[model samples]
Target: MQSLFERIDRLNGKYNALVSLDRPRALQRAREADLAQARGQSWGPLHGVPITVKDSFRTAGLRTTAGYAPLRDSVPDRDADAVARLKNAGAIVIGKSNCAPLCSDLQTRNDIFGTTGNPWEAGRTAGGSSGGEAAAVALGLSPLGLGSDSGGSIRVPASYCGVYGFKPSIGKIARDGLIPPLGDPAREDSLTVVGAIARSVRDLALSYSILSGEPYGIDAAPQHAPRIAWTGEFPRQLMDDEVSSALEAAYRTLSDSGASVEKVEPPLDLHFLNFKYFMLNMYEFSPRESSPGLHKLFWLFESARSVFSGGIEANYKKLKADQREQVDLFDRFAQQFDCWALPATPTAAFHHQKSGRPIPIRHRGKSKRYSYWHATGGFAFLANFLGCPSVAIPIGRDRNGLPIGIQVVGRREQDTALLRTAAHIAERIGSTMPLAT
Candidate 1:
């Protein structure tokens, strides 16, 4: 544990992966764990493992800002449910990792902490809002990290950093003490989920079981090969050659491994689903309070309903309806296939740029401006929208040597099954491809 801290101290400056360190307390806990072992007391599964939590999760006595300026010095009186679970399992919290501002942006950078860089490529983004967690684990700073996913936050970073990230079905893990708290209205949208990012699939399963208060055997692989469904493209989505090729290779490998592989088209229109997701996200992120004077002005602005799309309440209703339809479609599809495999992202990690600027990409032999979120979240948004479990695993690298990932998605509330499938795929892929060092 001490050696891990020393390595973090040495590499943090270059990666900017961690925002706050609780080294003294962590070392003290490590000593206590060692003494407990010496006394012949049964230690927990994590034992003395050192792990980092995303800045958005409130850690007791440790500053958690969620990349917001207002909470820069705010320390919580109690740890978030996930954090407490890891601690009870004997894992020592070493520090808080960087995240997107208010967990809103696609890239991890804010006024409180600077940008986190990709460990594989110096100038490229690490991916966010869980960018720090993924980069830290990929660089060997920590073996495991806890991150939150809302609209691809966990999967995108894991894909970019060449690590494993898993998002369980909604309500599987308790969501308490998370910053930018998901209050009643946000719950209606139901997009955010706390998840884990790790260097290995087994570590992901271990940490997930601990956090979710589930047992180890729940994620065990099936005795026989499982049926898998896959697709290389989605409606109105474009993929870089490298990403498309890696996904194809993964499908071929799974087929060769005795898994029943089938190519299938998604039931719903992806572009329309993405639109509903965007509307709901905007409504959830919208400010709730306003000054009296501004309130009247805002009311007048809202009164012009025809000019604007709709009110937040109306958008929420439409989002709920869309969600139900999408869920039903996925449920029917899941009845036939055990899991669906897709590209984690359309492109590999790109050069770091300021948020809100259009990123240029080559598609169909032409240059085009791509929204960062649209590029990373196109395939990922479906899982969150339908409230299903999804796992991202590193498949191989692109022509430029950047990592590419494939996501295995399962039916709602079938997180363990999803993890088991992910483990099988990871074993096959890891044997053939060398992961990012």
Candidate 2:
């Protein structure tokens, strides 16, 4: 049988999922893993696996781009803290996958890297900002890959591409080297997180535990069936009929499996949600510490608007105002539920060229323009805004036969519990995709 790295290379042209390939290094690690096994020394859980990473991750000596030109040539001397942990657990980094510009957009295409196409439909988008990583795993380009989710970057792509992606409870996985590195004493804090995208929930959990370096402890043992909250109608609007039906079916599957499942409509503040999202995200380009390129971008915004109009000041005010609401939302959700479940994206993968643009997702014959075509990530942003964890599981296919996914989010630091629940749900729903023939 061909080694995993070889298999990925063989499929590269067809999928166009990977932006770079480190064949020699991956083969070197494979040989080392085989030798260690022969010596009766178990390398680690992911030993010998050829894993890919979103270019946003800082892999020592590898081209790390959050899919931007300015940072393309900027190689880090150290592996991202998460990357370091994965390596310690014996997973070899085979290559850096593509991502959005500055990891900013929802689609993976950017001026730096062309685009990442879907495995299921080559002409459709693979999903973004972690689209490339999801595409790789979905196409079996790699057994697993690591990605970051700021606003559904991980889950959206996985949902569209029919793969597994998890945004572990905030701070569960060390975020020292994730792109747009935040929390630098000299820098402002933004709400971005590093997570994993894989073909199976087991792979997602395994990668998280490896990165966390936490003793399995209480979570090592199998978990009992969970009480799940499945929301069919989105907090903002009713979802597409086909998409909503898939989610409802998934809930029924869990119920039949003996897990208690409820359909609840939680109140949400859409404006506050969007405000906080834009604020925290845009805060990354803070004038005090941003690079010249970012500064120039901000300058254009300032110049475009009238000085008397409170141009940049309005943006700051909205951000600060939303921060308060952001805190309230987090506190309220912690009290009411163990986790919230909903569609990860409204629809499946669309045509490849249409990846990044916002499209009208029709629900009950009423069309509404969402944030992005995959904007059903309204469920995902809740987890991110609150610094919570969420896992996306493939539910079934949409009308087009592309994958449909649902996300289950949990309280902060409940990473393992959420993973366990998703695993149980996937088992009940029979959602795992068959290997591509």
Candidate 3:
């Protein structure tokens, strides 16, 4: 544990993966754990294992800013429910990792903690808002990291950093005390979930079991071989050739392993679904009313107008209706297949850019640029919308040696089954790769 802290201290400056550390406390806990073991006291499964929690999770006495400058000094009186559960399992929280401001962006950068770089390439982004966690795990700074995913936060970073990330179905784990809080309408809707990022599928499974308070059960592989569905293309989205090829290779591996693989049309309109998702989040994040006085008066007027015109509420209802339709469609599709596979991202890690510009990709012999959100969230948002479990596992590398990942999605509330399936696929395809230096 001490050596891990020393390595973090040495490499943290270059990767900016961890923004804050509770080294003394973590070391003290480690010593106590050692002594307890020596005394024949049984410890938890994660006893003495060092881990980093995403800054968005509130940790008692540990500053959790969520990369927001105004909250730089904000320290919670209690750990987030998930964090507390992990602690109870004897994991020592070494530090808080960087995140997007308010956990809103796809890249880890904010006024409080500049930006986290990809462990494989310093000039590229690590992916966010769990980018820091992924980078830290990929660089061997931590064995496991706790992260949150509303859209693609956990999966994107895992894909970019060549690690394993598992987002369980919403409501599987308690959500109290996360930044943005339970009172926030966005969280009230349960779009975000506490998840884990790690170097192996087994770590994800263990962490999920500990954090969710559910025993990790094995899903017996089908005697007749499981059926897998996949889609390589998305509407109005451009996928890099390498990413597409890697996904295809993964499908071929499953097919070769006796799993029936078939190409299928996407069950929903991704563009419309993503658009509604963005608008819904925007409304949820927006202030309910302005400060008192003239601003408050104007806010009242706007609220009244919206109420009379059936504005925000109407839009929200329509979004929910559409979401239900898509979820229903997905459920029907899942009934016919054991898992759905898709590209984790349109491309591998791209160069870090502050402007939040559209990312360019060549498709069908033409060059096109997609907004960063759409590029990364295209395949990932569906999981959140449907409240389903998904796992991202590194498959292979691109020409530039950047890691490529494929996502395996399962039915809602079937997190353990999804993890088991992911582990099986990982073994079949040899998905485990050495971490980047």
Question: What lDDT does each candidate get?
Answer: 0.82, 0.74, 0.83
Weakest lDDT window of 10 consecutive positions for candidate 2: 283-292
RMSD to native for every prediction?
Answer: 3.2, 3.7, 3.5
Candidate 1 displacement at residue 193 in angstroms = 0.5
Instruction: List runs of model 1 lying over 4 Å from the truth.
Output: 182-189, 218-223, 285-315, 430-437
Q: Per model, how many backbone clashes are there?
A: 0, 2, 0
Ranked by TM-score, the better of candidates 2 and 3 is: 3
Per-residue CA lDDT of candidate 2, range 205-310, in tens?
8788788876543345554457677677745444666787787787787887787787876646644575566546555432233345755675576556637656
Between candidates 1 and 2, the one scoring higher on lDDT is 1
Preferred candidate (TM-score higher): 1 or 2: 1
In model 1, pairs of residues that clash are none
Q: Estimate each model's TM-score.
A: 0.92, 0.87, 0.92
What is the Cα-based TM-score of model 3?
0.92
What's the lDDT for residue 226 in model 2?
72
